[model samples]
Target: MSSLFKEVDYLRIPYADIKAATNNFDIVNMIGIYHSKNVNYYVYEGELFRSGKRINIIVERILGIQEVQLLEGVSVISRFKHNNIPTFVGFCYDKYLGGYLVSECEFMESLEQILNITPNPSIRKSEYRIRENLTCYHMLQICLGVARALSHIHDCHAIHGSFNSYKIFLDKDFEAKVVGLFENPEYFPLTRYTCYVDPESECLNIFLTPKSDVYSFGVVLIDVFCQQHAADQSWHYLEFPEIPEIEYTHFDDNIRKQMNSKARPFC
Candidate 1:
């Protein structure tokens, strides 16, 4: 990981550049917010006009250790070039308020929002085309896109510390793009929409591994197929663990078990 950072080439943007682009982080231009009381990083969405072209960007206001760590992580993450993964833009460091890590803004709705039928599209056009529910074809496309993104990241010897429905975005065309790749593990938030967390991660003794990613992938697949939130079902695994390993052979069984009986007709 250390070697990966040494070779990373990044676009260093000035604080004034970002401020001007976002209108001093004005409320009117603010399109979204991602923050928590415990975390110092506050993410905001705004349109950036660069070279006379309007570009959507997500800016993360970073302070203290987050600034150093995230900047280093972003160095490597920005090098990624994949259709299924979100592209990294640049970063800005300020003398007073700290720095900002910027990435290409996802204009689409999150998988969670889509599943819950409460999508908040960035524009009016996307809202009109967004579906209330995902079809089998849509689900398959999502799974394949996520799988390819994960494979590419793993091939690069990096882990997508944060992988969940909220981190997966679907454009108006329903093409999937996995976000939050190479995010700090400590700052990652917990979600109830999907239990796409590795069971081993709960144990202090066990460090995160690629197999952990495989486990989370299984959970995500189950959630997508069933169109169900895994938060309630996650407790069952804690109460009694049974599955030795998740494999392609177990796909049908897992989907069938998790799917609501009412959805049987559709299946």
Candidate 2:
């Protein structure tokens, strides 16, 4: 484990510290859960003490993986220092419980949670109500922030292998923080969010590229504008073959009504 993170400058926290911060992985602290093959990662919101100062954090406990398998992803995360990306706080590994990757708890809630469109039945409903009255302007800002984050990642010569709305979180001011980067795209499970997977990658067995991330982002755009999961509309292509384009009518009625003539042209 030491050799795996020797070059990485992030913290190497003790497993006991992580356990104490998260109250022994209590159910009340669990905010999210992500599945990759047989591995189940549980995300918990907690506070850690470092240098006599309290630091709020989000800890993702990775189950069913060896320490060596975590190096690539952890290294990639430590190099990112963009505003739209969550700050990598540190990581902890236990011989019995697998690994834990920690990040500063700067986000209020994930976009999936706030939009109430998560496919995961295990995710707890968001308790934060930062945006009770979401506006079209707010939605545009969220999209723009995510776009900038993607551009930054591409400039760094890395891809967010599994880019989707569920990986996007929001702050109290609606700023976007994209997480879950550097996933092995080829190994990413197709059972969940098959709608967001790029057709080229899914059908042709092609490796995920920057273009694949763009395709997923397009689906995320649809989710934001329609106020629904893109999977809900995945059957349209087969059901209405003649309608080759997504018409203006496809947008959520409330969001469509909010868009003026200028915005209509862009949509």
Candidate 3:
């Protein structure tokens, strides 16, 4: 641990160490840039980012930023105190790499990945699957989690500025922790562009506030219920317009009405 980090209460980490640990951006360790979230992504050292004696680090490449932006974002993320969001640990700079946002790396899969592979495919045929009391449980949990994250930031007078599946993750216990929004400039900015952002695709033009998060959350809900996936092989709900709403109001109702009822069960 660096003495600088130890001296501070949040986290103690050095930018050089994270680069070295991830093999200096080696392709072998490269997890693939999740371009969906506006920033270029390479899941280094696996989704779990554990350092020597400290917590793990979620390394990402946020295209545009300086120390000022990093600190500004840290000030906001650090104020978030909720189980649904990862604790804001600290931030760092790397001349070799871009500025880095370090947080208490949580172990979990994203809700997008969780619903991507549904055991029951037939359910997607209906619009009502979204409000289904049973299946929507996952959606409901995600909604609550997102609400909490948004509320937390709003309480601190900060805006998420980027809201999407790529910016959110599901912990081992299935808790949603919003991440990578303001942290990565180049990537996550575009992540919000899918919806929360205005048509122009600019940061100031984007609306990542709580209401915007709600809008993104609604899109996520529909995707999870419909089992829609994009041809690009990214987020399960990347195909937003085609399947934003379930075919019916109730899961049982959709079961009987889905025009594609003849399609294979969601396996």
Q: Against the true structure, what is every candidate's RMSD?
A: 7.3, 5.4, 9.3
Best-to-worst order by lDDT is: 2, 1, 3
| Candidate 2 lowest-lDDT run of ten | 240-249
Candidate 2 lDDT by residue in tens digits, 39-154: 66677778899878999888878787666656667776788899988888888776688888888865456687667665555556555553345678889999999999998887
Best by TM-score: 2
| Backbone collision tally, model 2 | 0
Which digits, one per residue and each the tens of the lDDT, describe model 3 over residues 17-136? 666755675665432245443344434432324543556545555554454455556655666778877766555665545566555654544454454432333212222222332333
lDDT of 3 at 187: 21
Backbone clashes in model 2, listed as residue pairs: none
C-alpha lDDT of all candidate models, in order: 0.59, 0.72, 0.50
**Any runs in candidate 3 off by more than 4 Å, and if so which?**
1-12, 20-32, 36-38, 42-54, 117-135, 182-192, 198-209, 229-267
Give the poorly placed runs of model 2, Cα more than 4 Å off: 1-3, 36-38, 94-96, 119-132, 183-193, 232-249, 261-267
Against the true structure, whose lDDT is highest? Answer: 2
Question: Candidates sorted by TM-score, descending order?
Answer: 2, 1, 3
